[model samples]
Target chain A: MMDAWDDYSEKVMDHYENPRNVGIVEKANGTGVVGNPACGDVMKLTIRVENDIIVDAKFKTFGCGAAIATSSMVTEMVKGKSLADALEISNRGVMEALGGLPKVKRHCSVLAEEALKAAIADYEKNRRDISPAA
Target chain B: MNLIYMDHHATTPLDAEVLAAMMPALTSEYGNPSSNTHAYGHAARYMVDSARAQVAQLVGAPRPDDIIFTSGATEADNLALKGIAHAKDYMPARNIVTLAIEHKAVLDAARRLQKENVEIRFAAIDPYGVVDLDDLAAKIDKNTILISIQTANSEIGTIQPIREIGVIAKKHGVPFHTDAVQALGRYEIDVMRDHIDMLSISAHKMYGPKGIGALYVRRGLKLTPIIDGGGHERNMRSGTLNVPGIVGLGKAAEIAKRDLKSESERLLKLRNRLEDGILRRIEHVRINGHPTNRLPNNLNVAFAYVEGESLILACRGVALSSGSACTSTSLQSSYVLKAINVPDFLAHGSLRFGLGKSNSEEHVDIVLDLLEKGVRRLREMSPLYDMAKEGVSIESAHFSRHARGK
Candidate 1:
């Protein structure tokens, strides 16, 4: 009988209802996908990087409300940040930024964090390939 | 906010007539039924007896005395499973046969009996969540004390062939018990014709008050008391009677019996409309439960690439339930869906819509619109959906294997 929205914070619900930077980031740079369909959560993150700084970040996520909210929050947190700074954004940071999720939903934040880190890792790998002496 | 109550399988609002019937017990008619010395006691006893007869009539029990009131269906189910299994006469037969998709009330109690060295065999369910009668009969043997199966599943709404299962139990001379909480008023259940030894039902599921249910024990069936107290209800269950709840249950039963035929047809139509609309509007959806033999009021569906909880939340004005792992505290999807061989990814997206007396064509249309929009929006944000659109095989994706080893 509990309302499905009762456990969510306003900020979480806000991001879930109006996600930031949704969809793939054009044809440039790196894409990181984490989680999986079987567990009911999969997050795909894409970043458009320029001069080692993430200028654009977007996400495509298949998950619960918390998962979507966390994905949205993490993308906003990484936008305009350097690759190193974006990598420092942890799962706890995403949760805190969204005013914390339910205890059971904390894993969703972890997925967001993982997706962001993987995207940065992908960008670094692509950069290394492009200029070997950089 | 007028939220559509589509989660009737969880519980129902109390009927007006049931509340009216219960008001007397809650107010001035509050006297102990056992205290036979006073006029107040006589009045209380008369009301209790009448309510008992009403409940007995609803289920077609031969005698009013056959019904033993309990706290709710959970207690009734526990008593039917444990009380019968632990009975001195049946102790020698230490095995029980039940379906894999029974409610936790029956399954958990059977599990506890397992710790006491009682062998429990779970009969398999087919893709539509129907019990395989052949598998059930094969599991029953000379050592089987009881064959317990649900009349209908709450999650998927698949109505079992209870009469056939009864015949199987009778052939093997095993006591047949059914947790009929979901099917009590929705389907025609006659204990005599079905050869049912015990059946559990709850009032709340039938639009009565909560905290009142009964276990119908066939004449001459012996069951050990689970709650040993003042030797009430023929010494099988002991406690002070919940007079108000009992009156509510009795009135609810009477109303259900009177309207069962018409209400079922109405619900079936609304359910079909909802089902048909969702199928027409949504893409890559799969319906759960038996297509024909399911409860008239239940419709469960799995929307691929969209998680169940997210959809339920997105359709905010409608009340619903999900079989997804994210909805449960344990993070495990519905065992009933799992037993029916629904893939893990699909199971995570399963939603149960339980239509009730309040649902109408307008409500169904509203729900369909909300669902279409919700599924579309959620799928838009889905990575798997994108992959599927691009011709990637989601089944071979094996998404769980890459769950960071969680």
Candidate 2:
């Protein structure tokens, strides 16, 4: 009955329907939150790193369907990957993961990529602060 | 199953009688109304004239020739604003005064004129979108040539005191043009009686076919033509007459005029039921426009802390507009709400439900139930609600705090 699901690849639909790592991580070592008051779409990303790897990543997005799906895809892509590899995850990569979004909804995926980059940047800043010699 | 349609402010279904009246024009009797010396033209002209009479009767115009046909309200608006702006006597120094809450057709036209060195002044509206009469009066000067205001706002459904505003424009000896697109046929409008110099009306708004509209230019008011062509619409707008569309419009006007009283009463009851049902069932909801001074078929409410898009998605069975149908495609906040000082948080959560010919008590009940459920669910997950419950005002949260440089 929901044949429209076929437009999306199996992987994209899986992430959209059963999103992974969905929610906020409280008082985390690294957090990135981006908000667009205009469209009322907001994204908050939290990361926990052990060694040089992204040990855990999670996200919460308050937006339309594309936005929520994009954030979910971001979390799934970043998981089990090194912090540098996760930081390299691009908006174009997210779009490719989800087939594609309507032109108007492309902003949603772009926001997810920005949120992930911000989180990685925050983690690097924290590491630099902790290391007295730089 | 009983179906309900709440998009009356959008194009309405053609009345059966209107369709009957328009059949002849769409069938064999079609002819160019401008063509002379032919039986076809005579019949076509008769239908056109009859439709004009029907429209004139509804508006209480003293004569039928005062009405000029164009495409719908958007075209009418463009013609009135640009026509007046380009009149040879029109001075660039003369500012155009209009309210902030006007339809974009008018607002964007004014913006275009401003680019051509026409000074445009936007009068402020109160939080409820009612133009401040004092602020409007203060903005008028000898250099002000024209003022355009919508008779009723399409978004909030708030009715401006156009008659009062018309009096003010007359006092200042400036021409007043109203975008009566939303108010025509629903309300009584007479160019002379209302002291209006020019008015814009759309056919599709009152169950007429799309691509047909009319503008009321008071007789003897000389304005330059916006469309340069074969001297159509008394040279104000030049284009081939859309005979079929005009026939639909005329038939719609006739039916709307005949049924105005009873239909208005019925719409008011349905609208009130919808408003009361939702308010009684839902918490933290506020009506957007003035209660008494609004369209009988409109009920706009701000569902505090609930995302409007989510609520719409949840209630997919009923098709209704959030704000302007145009802006809904874009995920941006409603400019009308932002203009009237609806805080960003509440503005994003606002919903517009326009009642029309098809809504009923049962439909209202269904909507109310769905809305109650939708609002409760969405608000439960909203962080804004959590902040509000903790006694943190959104304004204080913004103005009192700045992110510490980390």
Candidate 3:
């Protein structure tokens, strides 16, 4: 039988092998973590959101190659975008960037998008709490 | 890359001797066994009868007539469950009792039977994947018609207590069936001694040709035919015989019987060496399945920080399965490991190695080396693994509460 990696595109395999932006951003302005412990894939995304634009983004994910690659791709996708634009970046965009994941690994792409939104949401929550604009 | 096949539970390479036995059938011996009135037919009939006797002997059944040929174990399983459930004599006892971890063939058949208003009861298994005897005892009542459990799980390789379960079935007077597709060639099974009323075996699983199998039904038991046709195989199964495949199955069975004891011993030693090597080399790794009751040729281990899919993908040089091939398409890890209450990380990270005739000490060592390297590489990329090594409980780690229903 053919290996499961055969279903993946060369780009997905490349991103998985040499994942970019790996590690934590401690004391970051906004941090998002998503995934179910029961499901065996988890993601923690840290972002430096300054003046409504994402200045820097980094990720640490625990999942299959697709999830890790998607997270890495998501970090790159949102690096220079506004929070609204980052939020607009869909899971499909991440999957497309990676060429594609297998049918079974498509769910990992969703994890990438969710982790980003969660980080942005965390930023909004932290901002609202600190600001008198509430 | 030269791939070393470690996935014997999926299927095995055809034995050379079995191929030799099947050559005549595949070549010049093309006579129809049903044409018994002439020499051409008589010769075919002779080959069929001899093959039938070999199959019966392998399973320790008294009468050769007790076996019915089918396409494969899937068909055999379907016939056993559906044939018996549809039997006029068994309608009053309308319940089917089987384990949760049975192959999809048995489980799917039971689902179909349930749709026909047959009550299907799934017996629970313990943490080690052994059927709970107490749960089974409570489930099998007078209304339970058939009790089906696998002799050995195809994924975890945990062998069930079939003899004890068979004794219970006998006490309740319910017919017992076992999907012995994985156990027959690897272990010894005697239908009479085990009180098995019916058993399922497939040729491809035993180093025989594919597309052939047999269902052993205790004599004097009547079955409602699933395939109604030329009334072949004493009306139990109907259709033209797969003469070549049958000959291969027969030869495979004969060889299995002859080599079972010695081969199992060798496999056991090799399996232990491979398993021990992995345990010694890696941290946070565990051996899955029963400690003593597992198949001699099977080794399942859970690598703490890696997903099985990723591991198999990287170690393409060693052919392996994360679970059964049937369910590998799904991403939910393994239901067998889940049913046994193994943690999700460990369960998702498990690999099943089915050592067979082709595997040797060299192959085992290479696989172990590949596994150690692969697990280490994958763990380096896993952040949850980072937390684990630092003694931080993953369950206690704070996670953002994004709505996950989508």
Candidate 4:
């Protein structure tokens, strides 16, 4: 029924409609993609690292309203924070910032956290590989 | 903005004529049909009789007395299946067979019967959501006491090859039952001609009031009473008659019979226009059900790279269901779609649009426009869409497993 929308918070709906930072970060230091096809949602997180701090964060997510909204919220939460602070962005925090997601869609929040951590891991991998050359 | 309702498969708005027909029963004509000696009771009895006749006419039942009113299709289905299952409890036939895509009423009833030691066999459905005739034939052996299938699936709107199924059941000397809840008003049905021995239908699906349904059993069929009470509905079902709901159902049935021929054509025209417009506008979309044999009032499509929930929420001012009514609330992708071999990702993106008599070409256009924009907006933000655009296969990308603690 149309009332199914009531299950989602207004903030969640907003990010789904007008999601911020929706494209890939070209020539990025690291990109993290997390999600199984079985889950019906996959998230890709991109980060620009400068002086050990995330200067910009962007995401492209293929998923439900909660998944997309959570991805957008995670991007907004991590920008202007150090890698450690960004890593501290928990799934519960992302859900809280978006008001809340339904019980069934709470995994979208977990996907957001997992994707962010995966991106940071990729950045560290890049740093480890390039520091020897520098 | 006024929302345009397109999810008629879930339920419909009560028609004005049905409301008018039901109003007297609810108020001034409020009398127990059982107390037939009194004037008030006589009036109520007459209304109930007329309603029974009207509904019988709608389904071409040989006798109105064969119709037993229940709470809804769920109850009707439970009564038809469980009643027959328990009635033949001592017989050698200990198994029942039904389609994988049947409504929860039949499925759950059969499941309960299974728990009580009745072997339940679920016939597989083809990728198009049609019950595989070969699989069905193999499942219905001499031990299979009853075979139940839906005339039209509520989720995908795929109409079954019911006549052939009925003939098979007849050939095997088994009683064939169909959950015709979705097909009652949309298609013409004749119990005898179709070889259907028992059938179920609900009122709300046909623009009648909710909480009222009927089960039609062929004459001379032996059945045990499910709801035992004061001997109402020929002792098969016993309860106070729902006079208002029955009246509304009768009026709806009468109107449906009169309008079905022309209404189906109109709905077909509207549905095709909606489907064609969305297909032309959207980039990676697939219609879920049978292209030609689907219900005229139904359109189900899966939009690539768009999540089912987000797409529905994004398309404001148009009412739709991401899945069928029964399973829509669950986060799980549609089981019907899964049974039909729709990939999990595409299954999650599917939406069902059920056009009703209330819809028009203008409404169709508006819905198509909204759907196109909504899918685009969501896909734009989708990483999977991005990968898909770059010729990446999403299924191949996610073969790795994850280990996360924080």
Tell me the TM-score of each prediction against the true structure.
0.97, 0.87, 0.93, 0.96
lDDT of 3 by residue, B231-287 (tens): 999899999999999888889889988898999899999999998899799888888
* Residue-level lDDT tens digits of model 4 in B1-406: 5888889999999999999999999999999999978999999999999999999999989899988888889999999888888889887658888877889899899989888789989888877888888999999877888999999999889999999999999999999999999987788888988999999989999999999999998888777888898989988899999999999989999999999999999999999999999888888999998888889999899888777877877777778888521225555678788888888878778899999989999999888888888887788787777778799897677533432221
- Per-residue lDDT tens digits of candidate 2, residues A11-127? 655665556777665556677766543446556788887777777788865555566678888888887789878878888899888888766556668778888877888888998
Between candidates 1 and 2, the one scoring higher on lDDT is 1
Give the per-residue lDDT digits (tens) of candidate 2, residues B71-130. 888888888888888883446386889988888899998899888788889888888788
Per-residue lDDT over B321-351 for candidate 1, one digit per residue giving the tens place of the 0 to 100 score: 9999999998888888989999888999999
CA shift of A129, model 4, Å:
2.8
Off by over 4 Å in 3: A50-55, A80-85, A131-134, B323-327, B389-398, B401-406
TM-score winner among the candidates? Answer: 1
Q: Which is the winner by TM-score between candidate 1 and candidate 3?
A: 1
lDDT of 4: 0.86
Give Cα distance to truth, residue A131, candidate 3, Å: 4.6
- Report interface Cα RMSD per prediction: 2.2, 7.2, 3.7, 4.4
The 0-to-1 C-alpha lDDT of every candidate, in the order given, reads 0.90, 0.76, 0.86, 0.86
Cα deviation at B200, candidate 2, in Å, is 1.0
Q: Over the stretch A1-134, how does candidate 1's per-residue lDDT look in tens digits?
A: 45889899999999999999899999659888888777788999999999888899999998899999999998899988988888889999999999989998888888898888788878888988988693
Measured by TM-score, how close is model 2 to the native structure?
A: 0.87
Candidate 4's C-alpha runs over 4 A off are A1-5, B324-327, B399-406
lDDT of 3 at A39: 71
- Flag regions of model 2 displaced more than 4 Å: A1-22, A25-29, A47-58, A120-134, B1-4, B88-92, B323-331, B393-406
Chain B vs. true chain B: TM-score per candidate: 0.97, 0.94, 0.96, 0.96
lDDT of 2 at B163: 88
TM-score rank, highest first?
A: 1, 4, 3, 2
